[model samples]
Target: MAYKELIGSFDEVRNYIREFFIYGIKKRSDFSDKSGRTYDNRRRQIESWLDGYMSFQQSASGKAQIISVDSREVVHNPLYKAFKTKNFSDYDILLHFCILDMLAGGKELAFRNIAGELQEYGFSGEENVINERTIRLKLQEYEKLGILKVRTEGKKKQYYSLSADAVDLVSWQDAIEFFSETEPMGVVGSFLLDRKELAGCQSNFWYKHHYMLHAIDSEIVETILEGIAEKKYLELVTSGKKHSEEKIKLYPIKLYVSTQNGREYVLGHVSGASGLDFIRVDRIKKVKTGIRCGEYQKFENEYQASKSYLWGVSSGNAKDITHIEMTVRAAEGEEFIVRRLEREKRNGHVYKITDQQYKYVVDTYDAMELMPWIRTFMGRIEKLESSNPQLKKKFDQDMEQLYSMYFGEAQNDIS
Candidate 1:
C-alpha cells in the first residue's frame, strides 16, 4: 500500500525540508514564520513522508528534530520520495484524466474545443467551478510544456498532443552525478537517474549549508528571468535592512547567487538612482510585472561596468571607486597561497614581489564590503593600505579587537 501524506501548501513542504532536513538541528520556534498549528501539520506530514528517517533529540533548551540518513545504511536519498508525494486535490486528478481522454483521439483542439468537450463530458460536480477559463489555462500550460503542440493557421490556433522531450541515461550519466552532488535542486536530476534501471549515481555531496528553498523559489527566479528576457520592468515589494514594506519599480538587470552561502539575489536599479541596487529573493514579499523595460540596454551597460567595481554585491555611485592594496608574506611551502589569492581575486591583480612575498590589489566601489575577506589573512597581511581612510581605520580597529580578544593587553604592552 502507498502512504499518501497530505500537505496544505508548497510552503508546508518547504518548511519541513528547510527546518528538519536541509538545515536541521533546529528548535520548534525556529519556524516562527508559520502558526503553531500550521507548523505541527507540516511536521506530521514530513514524518509520514520520510518515516523512519526522521528522529528527534533532546537538547538543554528544547527538543530538536532532524532527518538522520546514513549513506552507508540508506540505499538512496529519502528526500527523493518527498518530491514524489505532492498532495494533489481531487479536481487536479480529475483534470489530468480528462485532458488525456479528450486529447487521445489524435485530435487538434482549441481551448474552447477542449473546454466544451470537458463540459459535455461533465467534469463539474455539484459545487465545482471547472469553467472554460480553467480548462483553457490547463491546455495552454500543456502546450508550453511540450505535452501538446500548437498550430496557427490564418487566424485560428489549435493544439494537439506532441511527444515530450525525453532524456537519455547513457549521455547524462556523468552530468547527472556531478549535478546531483554540487547544485541546488539536483534532486530532480537525481530523481531522473532513478527512472533509469541504473538507480542513483554513487556520487554524493555532504552539503554544510544547503539552501534548498532556492529550488522552491525557482518559480520566482524564472518569472524575474522571463521579465528580463522580455526586457520588462519589475514591481517589487521588498522588506530588508534599508526598506520596510516598500513597493518600488525596478528595471530588470541580473540575478546574483552567493557561492559561499546559497542565497540568491536580483540586481537592478530603481528609477533615478545613480547606483545599482540588489534585493534578496527570500526577503521579497511580492513581485509583479510593471512595464516594458524600453531602456534596458542602458541599464544592461551600467550593470556590465558596475561588475568591475564590485568586490561583493555592494556597489556605490557610478563614479565611486576605492582602491585597496595588500602585501602578503607567504611561507616556503605555501606557494599555493599565492595561487589561491590570484584565482579567487575577482577584478584584482596579484604580483609576485619575491620568493616569499606577494602583493594583492583591487579597485572596488565599496571598500567596506571587501574588509571581511581581507581579515581572513590576518597573520600574513602587511601594509593594508586603502584609498578610503575610514575603511583603513575600521580594518585596523577590527584587527586590534581580534588581537585584544585573543592575546589580551599584553600584546598592546609589546607594541
Candidate 2:
C-alpha cells in the first residue's frame, strides 16, 4: 500500500529482483503471479537500492526496466545491499539498541538485573513496554547467533556480549577484498570490510568476470550447508516453471558450483527416489531442516560412484550412461586446440588419432548437457558420434540451421 525501501520478505524481494533485474523479464504481465501494483511497489523498492545500476529500454512488449552491471568495474557487490534492507519493527529496533547499550563494554548481567535496567531506562514506558520474557528470548536468540555468550551462576544464567577479535586489516585486507568478491557467502567478508575500524579502507582488487547476483542466494546456501553437515534431510520449497511451489524432501549429498557460470546446485536424492536430483540453489524459496537421515552415507557413496559420469549437474539416470566420441582436426601449429580439449574435458579422455587429428571420448550421465561446450569446437570437429542418437541428431539439426542462416540453402545442396 505504501512505498518503503525495506522489504519484510527477502524471498518476495529476491524473486522480483531476480526476474526483473537479473534475468531481464520484461512486461509486468509476465510476472502473472502478482498484481501490477505489487510489481510496481517491489520494483520501486529495488530501484531505491539499485538506482545507479538501473536502466530503461524500449521493447516490443513495452518499456522495460533493467539492471545492467559490469561486475569487473564495481569494487563491491551492489546486490549485497538488498540483504541489508530487511524490515525491522519499531519495538525490535528500540529493544536492539537498549539491550546492546545495557550490555556495553564486556559487561555481564543476570536476566533480572538486565530486565530492571530496561525498565529503569523507560523501556517499560506506556508507549512501548518490553517485558522480561521478550528480553530473555532475544538474549537466547543472540546467544545462538554467537553475539551473546551465556554463563550459569548459582541457578541463574548471565548473558554478555561476545565481540569479534580484531584482525590486522592491513595485512588481511587484500584477502578479504578478494574473497568478498569471489567466494560464496562473500557478504560476510563485505560486512567485515564495512567495520568502522577500517574507515580508510580501500579495495585493492577487482574481478574480471564476477558472478555477484548469486550473493542473494547465500541464505539458502547456508541452510543447505547446515543440512549437509548435520546429515539430515531438508524440506525444500522450490518455485517451478509455472510459479507453483513444490515441497521436496531431499537428502543433500553435495553442493555443485559451476566454474563457467557460478550457478549453484544442491545434489541430493528425493525421498523414495532411486536417482539423485540437482536442484538449482536459486530456485529454492525456503528450507526446513528435517530429521537426521540414517541412509545419508549410502546416498553419499552412491553419489561418489556416479559422479565420475557427471559432466555437469545432469545425472540422467542410474542405468543410462551416454557415450560420446568427438574427433577434431588440430593443424600442426594449432596444438593449443588439442591442449584446450585436454584441459577443459572433465572425466573425458583425449588421445591423438593422427599427427594433425585428435579423438576425445567419454561416458557421461548426459551427452545433451555437453552440447554447448561441443559447439565451441564446431569448425574443428571432424566427426561427432554419441550412444544417444538424439544427441547427434540435435547437433546435426543445429549445424544445418546455422549453415542455412549464414550460407543460405547451400547447406541442403551440400548435404
Candidate 3:
C-alpha cells in the first residue's frame, strides 16, 4: 500500500475507535460478518495499532490518559448533570484535548504540527478552520496557569510538563466543578463552555474573579443587546432592591464588563443624565420599547468619541478630565500587571507602570463608581497623584481623615 493510503487507513481506524468509545459497541466483530482470515487480519491490525497508541500516550510526560469508559465506573456528579441538562457543546474542549495529546512528552510541536493532527482527527472542515494564532494563544494560557511550560528554540518551540495538578477533563462533572468555582452562574458558564480554547480543565484565579456574569436575566439581557443593535429606544424601570422605585429612559448603545467585579453593565444615553450612564441589567425592571430612534443618529459621534475614556461604560459629563495617578506595587510573580500595562499602551493610553511598580490615570466622570477599583489597589498603592494640586490636597486630606477615624477607634477599643 502507498504511504498516503496507509495513513488514511490508520485515520479511519482511529475514527472508528473514537466512535466506539463515545457509543458503546461490544467489538468490531459486532458489525462484521466476514469470518476467518479477513476478520482476524483487520482485528489484529486494529488491536496492535491501539496498543501502540496507548503505549505512546502513557510514555508522554504531559499526556492525559484516555479513560476506557467500559472499565471505569461513571459517576452522576452535579457537574455532569448540569452539562447534560444544558446540552453544552464540547467541540472546543475536544480540540484542546487533541492538541494536548499531540504536544505530550514535553515536546514543543510547531503550529503546523498541532493543526495537522487536529485535521487528521476530523476537526477541520471547509467552513470551520482553526488558525495557528488561536492554538498559540491556548498554549500560552496553559503555560501561564502552570499546566504547561513553553520554550522557544530559535523558532521551533517545545512545551514541558508542569505537574499534572492543573489538568482537568471536559465531561459534565468536570464542567460543573470548573464553572461552579469560576463562573457562579449558567450564563457565564455557558459562554465559557462555548470557547474551545477556554474549556480546558485548568483554572486561573484572576480569570475566575474577573469573568463573572452579573445578576442579569440572560433572556432579557439578550433582548436589550438586540434592541441596541437595532437602534431602538427603551423605557425601563429599575427593579433591584435599591433602584426598584426609579423609572428611567435610555438609548442603549454598548455593553460593558467590569474587570474588578466580573459584572456586565449597559452603557447608553440616559434621557436625564448629562452624558452616557451605565445601569446594571439585573437591576432593570419593566423594560418596554418606547421610540423608533430616528433622531438618535446625532448622538453617534458623541458616543464614538466618548469610548476612549469610557472604562466600564459609565461616561459622565465632566468636560474637565481628572488626572488621578496611583502607583501599584505588584506582588512577586505577578507579571500580569506588566502585560496589562502593555495592552493599555497598545490601546493609546499612557501606561507608565513596570513589573515592580506601575502608575495609571483614568478620566472618570463619576469618581464614586471608581472607588471599588481604588480599594482593590489600597494594599499595593504607595503613591497617588493628581493633575490639579488642590484636588490632590483634598484627596490626601480625605484619606488622612478616613485613616485617622479608623485608627482612633482602634486605640479607644484597646484602652
lDDT of 1 at 79: 63
Predicted candidate 3, C-alpha RMSD: 21.3
Question: lDDT by residue for model 2 over 133-235, one digit each (tens)?
Answer: 7888888888888777888866666746655655677688888888888888788888878877655687777778888878989888888989999999999
Q: lDDT winner among the candidates?
A: 2
Off by over 4 Å in 3: 1-216, 240-247, 271-274, 318-320, 327-337, 343-348, 351-362, 367-383, 387-415
Candidate 2 lDDT: 0.84
Model 1 agreement with the true structure over 1-415: per-residue lDDT tens digits: 2434765445446545664565664577766664777667667777887798877778787888877766555434566566666667776788878888777767666666777777666666777657666676776777776678877756876655655446677676777765654454456565677765447446443545444446555545666787778888888776545434778788878788887766888888787776678878766656777779778888899888778888777867655888889899899999888887987888888998888889998899888888777878888886788889988788767777878888774244321
Worst 10 residues of 2 by lDDT: 406-415
lDDT tens digits by residue: candidate 3, 1-415: 2111122223233333333322233244344445545434544444443343222122223332231322122221112121222222355577657767776665666556666777887767776676777766776777786667655667665644443543343545456545543432445454444456445545432221323223224444666776687888888777546323578878888776555555667777788666667787656645666766775775666788766555445565557455666677776797676565556431234455565777766665444444545555555667876665665555555566666788753222210
Better of 1 and 3 by TM-score: 1
Q: Quote the positional error of residue 258 for candidate 2 in Å.
A: 2.3
Q: What is the lDDT of residue 103 in candidate 3?
A: 64
Candidate 3 clashes between residue pairs 3 or more apart in a chain or in different chains: 79-172, 80-172, 80-173, 92-196, 108-158, 353-358
Which scores greater on lDDT, model 1 or model 2?
2
Rank order by lDDT, top first? 2, 1, 3
